[model samples]
Target: MITTRVVKILYVLALIPISLFSLLMAVYGLAWIDDSAAFGYLLLLASPFVWLFQVFATRIVLEFVINQFKISEYLRAIKDKG
Candidate 1:
């Protein structure tokens, strides 16, 4: 469970690249950029959905890990008591 929290923190930290890339792209207009570059710039500019998606992904992963850890701990306690 503790490790899972650390993982979640790392996931959040991963967003930093996305944010920085987006800001950089936004500073330079996509119109003058090449198509692929423009696309990347646009993607960065329009990445609110990406951020939201990451949030949901992190939540689901954390929830599953926490639940699994709790279940395993519970089972271990039961086995120890028995």
Candidate 2:
């Protein structure tokens, strides 16, 4: 329960950068999609890498924030709950 709150907090915080990256990428990449089919296909091909980067970055950031907080207590409490 405690770490649930912690994770939600970290997830919301992490969304800030991820969403900004998405918006920025969309703004710049949309031009390529509108200009030609080839560039649009290229964007499609590169989409997976973009998703991987965002997920990896968000995980790393969430882990970092978790470590910075009193997560050990929550972990212990969770273990006791089980």
What lDDT does the true structure give each of the candidates? 0.69, 0.71
> For model 2, what is the alpha-carbon lDDT of residue 43?
67
Error of 2 at 10 (Å): 4.9
| Residue-wise C-alpha lDDT for candidate 1, range 1-82, written one tens digit per residue | 4867786787778667756654554555455356577676666566566656666776777778778888999999999999
Model 2 agreement with the true structure over 25-51: per-residue lDDT tens digits = 655566677788677657666655676
How does each model score on TM-score? 0.55, 0.49
Candidate 2, RMSD to the unseen true structure? 5.7
Estimate the lDDT of model 2.
0.71
Which model scores highest in TM-score? 1
TM-score of 1: 0.55
